[model samples]
Target: MTDQKKTHQPQPPIAVSPDEAARLAGIGRTTLYAALAKGDLPSIKIGTRRLILVDAIRDWLAQHQG
Candidate 1:
């Protein structure tokens, strides 16, 4: 019998922190905050933590990219 505990797990991230979202979007922290402050980007607040959806970030990039 083979144990499944050694298997690798792969899961797609549904949400990301502002810093991580910035990194993925190739933008600075300040710019990411600015977008959030300006309501240009959408985020979900869980308690005190703010999370940005990966899908939203992609859409934002598509809208802004020339």
Candidate 2:
């Protein structure tokens, strides 16, 4: 009998600060903040770090793309 093992590769997590998120989304930081304020853009506030999920950003693009 032989044993086999499978290996899984990990993908880097997509993380961005407010500034980077604004740049990546092609929007101003104010607009981003406004959206967050209005609960339009989902964000997580852990400790003092606020993070928006990359997948959420992608979904936003998918639904809001012009």
Candidate 3:
């Protein structure tokens, strides 16, 4: 019998939940939701779950930077 070890690689997330988006943005969930509601942040609805793209989060933050 031979045993094989599996190797795992860490990859950046393409999409994140609202809570995760809030955490990544260093903001509260309410603020995240407000941004989403205002269309300042982009999100997608899937099976009653809302997810934000990592790129969108980055761009949104970049847009707000002075």
Judging by lDDT against the true structure, name the best candidate: 1
TM-score (C-alpha, index-matched) for candidate 2: 0.71
For candidate 2, the C-alpha RMSD (Å) to the true structure equals 3.6
Candidate models: Cα lDDT each: 0.97, 0.81, 0.94
The CA lDDT at 15 in model 1 is 99
Residue-level lDDT of model 2, residues 1-66, one tens digit each, is: 898888889975676677778888898999989888888888887889998887777787677778
Clash totals, every prediction: 0, 0, 0
TM-score, predicted candidate 1 vs. hidden true structure: 0.85
RMSD of each: 2.3, 3.6, 2.9
lDDT of 1 by residue, 1-66 (tens): 986777678988999999999999999999999999999999999999999999999999999989
lDDT per residue for candidate 3 within 1-63, as digits (tens), equals: 899988888999999999999999999999999999999999999999989999999999999
The lDDT, on a scale of 0 to 1, for candidate 2 is: 0.81
